[model samples]
Target: MLSLSGLALFAGIASAYVVSNGTTCYLYPESQIHLGRNVDDTPSIHQAFDQCGTNGTVVFTEETFHLNTVVNTTGLLNCLVELKGELLFSTNVPYWLSHSISVGLQNQSTAWLFGGTNVTFLGQGGSINGNGQTWYDENQNHSNQPGRPITITFSNSTNLWIENLRIIQQQFWATFVTYSHNVTMKDVYVNGTSNSRWNTVNTDGSDTWNSRDILMENWTVVTGDDCIAAKGNTTNLHVKNVTCYGGAGMTIGSVGQYPNSPDYDENIVFEQVRTIDTFNGAYIKTWQGETAGVSSNGDAGGGGSGLIRNITFKDFDMINCSLPLQITQCIYTEDAGACETSKSRYIEDIHFENITATSRYNIAASL
Candidate 1:
């Protein structure tokens, strides 16, 4: 278990709230709170949040809490969440698909929507299990399956700290921070894979969108999609000391999706990354041209403009990874002639430094 007690030393420097001397509220499995082994704990959790929203700490003790309903803990102010137990989301795919909160960006939905100012989530070697095997199987067979909910999302929030969490089997992206600033995620583990037959798809480890002044470090991710991805309108981001296995590598954009929307990502840096048996490492991908309708992943968009600048990837060690370095201006398009004629986004002032890798495929760099 990673202890966050050391964070107290740097709390002042980092501008993070430390509840060392604050009120402590413990949440339990109680019938009165509608929290039990089988009962939904969403209400109880919210009640705790209400009680300990400011200058306090909420602790989830070592027990299994079943969440059959969506829990939105947005607008939390100066609180600490200590997770020392398993937080399991129910496998009722249809129920969640219909009931989850619509996040309104790229058709994303979430089971847990956490927002607001100066919030900290410290998982004391605990797990947030999404129970995603059913969703993966359903998507494999049903071509028109409903959008699966994201495991956890932080949106429209600021000054957040998330550390030492074991997040597994996410139905969609594991941790998504968007439209926020001054966030830090460290010592986090994310895994979405199958030992049996079903395959997880689009289980990105962490995604940042329209956010700035973010830092992600000391992460271990084994997923089907990008380990860490920076999407449009992101700036002043830094990522380091991340180990990725069986996923798409660290990426910027799949941007330029919404037509006429100006996207910008700048001053981003990824350093000290280690990749094993992954797809791509240190990549930048963008869409091209104006055309769309029910695109891949049941989404639709095109002809968005963007500017990517002052980005750097350094100190990467790739072992048996495919496409160690890739920069593509044309993605999700088949018409070569159209791509040639389309007005693509601007990409400039990019740097790749101290990258050492062994490619599983024969190709080294793709541009």
Candidate 2:
């Protein structure tokens, strides 16, 4: 994305690799951005972003330091920049910024929202803790006035690579992307420890609501909610070699007039996955509510005709998943809740091979 320019950091740090932008920086073998210092990583990060000629890299040192917000209103994470850090070794953003997001609080963790083409956020077995304990209890009286502590927010980009990162304990969806293409989130570990009971809601691992060329592989997701959620007219997505535990399994089309403004999910692939103790192994159905986001599909779409086609799930092993494979076209109508059911979303060209399951509920495939 970027043309190599003044990459003092990459040039100093490593010799064999690709820099997002042509810009270079020497990532000193021994470097630390102390909490209290005149030197800053944000500037260094943006410097790479600046030189990406177009794309760049943001590498974090092995230190726990607070950070200022790297804001991008264009809904893009600058195509050439590379944002990486030495995981568990370096910490950034000690607390959330109140002025940056919709309802940001001190402990909110989903602080850094990133998206762009040719962008990579790689870390070495480190943790991006979204200290969600501060704002976990906003139920009736308040909406999410408290910001969701997510690792990254991808919007409208192409060619993304997120690997070897441990994203944990966020207040909301861990990684939420919208309108992007050719994305890959691999070798990623998303976890939600029950340190606080209220600290978990919608902690989705990787959500491709409306995009394509998505690939999520070799991942372990133990979250408070859906491990991987697909929504509204998504196309050409792939989820392979993953293990999901303690949440909803790979979900497609929790459809409720979603895409909020566009096409739905199609051409998805889920292979070599194992699910354990979750709500459902693979779900494809529209929700009941559409007008508002308050209730979880209480009264929704005219029914999905958005084509959940060409889906392939092979070599899937399930153990004790509550409701293993449910494909329902049944719509939840107003008067009866389960009434309107006439070709909701077309589930064509679907194939399930070498699938083994031990579910409390029967393996029901609604065609």
**Top candidate, metric TM-score:** 1
Can you tell me which runs of candidate 1 are displaced by over 4 Å?
1-22, 30-37, 141-146, 341-344
Candidate 1 whole-model C-alpha lDDT, 0 to 1: 0.82
Candidate 2, after superposition: displacement of residue 67 in Å?
4.0
Cα misplacement distance, residue 58 of candidate 2 (Å): 3.4
lDDT of 2 by residue, 1-367 (tens): 4447556545544432223324443232222323244332344444444554253334444444333454342333444322344322112333343443431211233455466656665666446665444435432223233443455667766777777767766556677767778888888888865555554566778777667888888999987667888876688888999999878788776654542443456778888989988877777766432233333332224433456677777788888887777775543444344344444445677777897888776654444
Candidate 2: C-alpha RMSD after superposition: 7.1
In candidate 2 the C-alpha lDDT for residue 309 amounts to 71
Span of ten consecutive residues with least summed lDDT in model 1? 12-21
Each prediction's TM-score versus the true structure: 0.90, 0.73
